[model samples]
Target: MATATGKNAKKTNKQTDTAGTKSSQKDGGSYQAKDIEVLEGLEAVRRRPAMYIGTTDARGLHHLLWEIVDNSVDEFLAGETDRINCTLHKDGSSITVSDNGRGIPVDKHPKTKKSALELILTTLHAGGKFSDKNYARSGGLHGVGSSVVNALSTEMIATVRRDGHEWMQSYKRGQPTAGVKQVRRIRGHGTTIFFRPDDSIFRRTKFNPETIRQHLEDISFIHGGLKIFFHDETKGETHELHHPEGIGAYLEKITTDGQKKSVHEIPFSTEKDDRGNRIEVVLHWTEATDEEVRSYVNGIRTHAGGTHESGLRTGVAKAVKNYMDVHDIKAKGVTVTNDDIREGIVTIISVFLGDPMFQGQTKEKLNNPELSGQVEGLIRPGWKRGSTPTRRLPTRSSAGSCSPPALAWPA
Candidate 1:
């Protein structure tokens, strides 16, 4: 091995081989454990929180809540958990979520040799979602949620009650203060995540109760009857949202009030196969003015309205047009363009499968191009199956009718 000085090449003395000895072969030098590399700590996140989280403002503050909620959603997807309890402190700077789902696995990760929980919290992009076999459905497709939240929070505490024991861990600015340690022995399984956004990183730590309420409310409606409780510890306020009728009840809640109904609500759904792929589709036709279609893959909202959304739109529009043509009903003067047809139209599209590709860090869209055809093909032909058209009156429905739909799915 040779050593050099940057200032000027300095010759290092080398011992000559003894008379009968042979020279050592050291061209590249020996590779050993000491030569192995390790990345620096989480200090980078403190320097650039925005790079990981989109912003350091109110959106970012809310992101902390989303990250935590994303975890609870994962539990909900797996049959391990159903209820998500969220509480906002009166101070408005903190929020906590408790889920009865199977808590994050506390076992060791084979690759990292660290507790899976710790690996998820400390390392970026580390979790079950990475392994196709382990996670069939995950909201946080790109596993940055926990680590990002840990990185941005001034303080975060995670409590895991599993396997007859209670384990707890805490972190500050991404560095774990203590490793995963048993806090106590418990009889059940679940997880509680409490976090306080760093004022240094966040311009404001205050949370919007309405935003949280709307978010949970939407999830409640989507999942339908998945008991979601919201409590404001600071204000002593508590509210619950759950729907038993599922999407049908969800549609009725949104479409029936004030003014005559112009377009009767119609639901089109069926199961179809695409290149050996199977998908189930649920769609509702409404004459409502705005085009409101929400797509979810395994409870994860595809807000971007990707192929799945496109497929539903294409399939439903084609099906409706075909239905009108078959009946020789000149909707000509009726003029139900896709936009017109969807105007004030509120529809929910959900696709459940073993494999789903969600685009981006937020998992807001279904990216699989095949998804469009899968979803569209499933509902296109089925549109006229058991289809009954209703007339829509040119009047607005009451708020009671518009009061967000209830969502209830059996636990």
Candidate 2:
């Protein structure tokens, strides 16, 4: 470890050696070759980036953005940060992200012994999120976000302000190009990452402003007053996505009532026994063109609705039909498909937990098979117990599932 011009630099060197033994944990006992397993080097990420971040195209590139954004969001959940800034550089080959959050700890990780910052960047499947004590809720709890991004980037610069000083590190293709070094002393705290995607891994390195805008807008809705600043230097534009009313504002923007009667917004919230789990649900129906049900597990989007959503659908359909039965509204041949029950429904389900089991490379689905039933069990009862409002839901034109609208990027 090298010290620089900072008041805190004279303190004890918090750096540790990058040496450790591979061990397996079984029945709370540690063992060793049967225990020791290795993933070789950066080759796994290069060969299977999609299995980690979802796609190899523009969406995958955007997933890199999410990985970095997730760290900032983790800070928000940890109650240490509130504002985040994302800038697309003029060259189009790089992105610079800065967040006013509790910066990544610059201390040494006990296991790997290197500066935690360096270990997180150079190694795979390592970070502070593994244990619930480290974070109350996290999006990249699997610890693949930063490492995967580093592996796929041609270059990366990470800077952190903590303990009254600024520490910096850089990486080239997942390996450190320079050792961890302190640069300057700074007030307050934050982390900034500037990276250029590897042309060898990513077919293109250009940034998409509209895509970033939409994502920041969506995240702003979820986070409610959290400020997110967007700067497209390539396009010479800057904007902020912040909503005081939160999801309500998001729904109002996307929903328009046509022939449907004004129905009460059915609000439901429940916490599970899964130690540090929260599920918040808001649902309302309109005469809108489609059903928009977005599910999130610990801030990560579950685009391919998993079992949790399936349970939600089943609970909604059952509750509605039960209410219809109680009212003696004689209607024949009416069966509630997930589609039928959710028609014109604008709903957002947010689940926050320390650890999320996600499906596949892109993590498009929540993979905690048990949690699906857990959410259903917790939420279904709420719906069943709530008083069902009386209103004739207008017949809606069925517009199946939504796909990404036309967005311009490299082919």
Number of the predicted model whose TM-score against the real structure is largest: 2
- Which 10-residue span in candidate 1 carries the lowest summed lDDT? 402-411
In TM-score terms, candidate 2 sits at: 0.79
Q: Candidate 2 residues 1-411, lDDT tens each?
A: 776546554333332211222122333345444886566777689887877777778989989988898889888888888899999999987998898887888897777778989888777778878886868778876677888899999899999998999999999988889888989888989999989898888878787889989888888888886899999998899998888676655655655423443245443334455555677666666656466788877667789988768777776666655555555643344433456556666777777766677776467887676666667666555644544444344333354323211111111
TM-score, each model? 0.77, 0.79
CA lDDT of each candidate?
Answer: 0.69, 0.73
Q: Model 1: C-alpha RMSD to truth? A: 10.8
Q: Write the per-residue lDDT of candidate 1 for residues 142-164, one digit (tens) a residue.
A: 67788888888888898998899
